[model samples]
Target: MDLDQSVIGLTSNEYVFEVERRHVGQFAAAIGDDHPLYTDEEYANQSAYAGLIVPPTFPIAMNDGKTEMPLALDQRRMLHGEQEFLYYKPIRIGDRLRCQIKVSDLYDKEGKSGKMQFLKLDTEMKDETGELVCISRMNIVYRSLAN
Candidate 1:
């Protein structure tokens, strides 16, 4: 698809995710993290977070295509670029998080291969109390095959 500036501000529907002990432990295990905070309820209960917590990258698992882009782009031409996460609060078990994805920016740049369109998407997650939990920024590059 051509670079569409209008898609910059487009946002996806909000998705709510409930953090579960099983899910957190599984995610931690999948990543080979044996930290007690992620799996040991007794140990985690005494930590500063006061309960079982998820690994730093656990939010990636929470995103199951629930917040897809409002517009469709050719997957063949899309390339995953960079991802950044900013945490405002710790993600703990039993916390309900409401998340929505927004297209924050759309721009084009000249690459060694060809002109590339960059799509920046931001996922903002808030707790049930409407407090900011975290924000994940993802960058995608769309390159023309003709290049």
Candidate 2:
């Protein structure tokens, strides 16, 4: 079995994008979590957070657009295995956030089906003020076609 590895790291300076209230709203709608914290400002104020907040999983739910950090995952055989998030600060409405993703680990396993490769990604998110917000770990499993 041949194991090819790659590291994909990006800093906040490299990724020039912002997540606004509208984006948060759309994400909330798509996830079916129509909570006030994710939609209405007025309603959000009544909660623990002073303003509207984005969903916890919003950071990892981004569609694979050009803005996304490039990955070597074989898209055809890629599968979302697991995800874990660690939040240090609150992500509120009107707060701009940036994330840099990189390959944390890569390896191939000789599974019964075939040679399955695991690509582990670590995404660090921060606020405008250079404060760490959350760190998300994503695992993608790729199984080769040959048995």
Candidate 3:
């Protein structure tokens, strides 16, 4: 796939996800986090948040095949470069979230592994009330086979 010409500025369809208590607990446990804010309902209710909260990386589970770039890049040749999340508010249980994903940037450069294409994607997540909750930035590198 010619990512530079095909993916940059591509905006994907919006996806909606429901945040359930079980999902929060499962994600926390999978990441080896036993924080009471995420695992214990009673403890969370007593805290400032007033309810169970999802972990910082809980957005990973929100990828339900609704937001996808049209690059058609090969998965085997793609490498995850970096990922960052900016949180404006905590993701609480029972909150329905919506995400709008976009391919913000795409470029090619030469690196130790030779020619590489960098694809930057951004996903904006909002709560059911339409309040911004978080933004996730993901960078992926596609190595050139001809290099």
Q: Which candidate leads the pack in lDDT?
A: 1
User: Rank by lDDT, descending?
Assistant: 1, 3, 2
Model 3, poorest ten-residue lDDT window?
64-73
Encode model 3's per-residue lDDT on 1-147: one tens digit a residue.
Answer: 455556677787888988887877778888899888887889999998887778888886777765566446688878888998888988888878898888888888988877778888888899878999988888888787764
Q: Measured by TM-score, how close is model 2 to the native structure? A: 0.76
Off by over 4 Å in 3: 41-51
- Which rank order by TM-score, best down to worst? 1, 3, 2
Which of 2 and 3 is ahead in TM-score?
3
What does the lDDT read for residue 52 in candidate 3? 76
RMSD of 2: 3.1
For residues 1-147, could you state the per-residue lDDT of candidate 1 as single tens digits? 487798888888889988888888778777899988877789998999888778988887777565677678898988889988899999988888998888999998988987789998888899988999998888899888783
Worst 10 contiguous positions by lDDT, candidate 2: 8-17
Better of 1 and 3 by lDDT: 1
- Those runs of model 1 whose alpha carbons end farther than 4 Å from true positions after fitting are 45-50, 64-67
Superposition error at 50 for model 2 (Å): 3.9
Q: Between prediction 2 and prediction 3, which has the larger lDDT?
A: 3
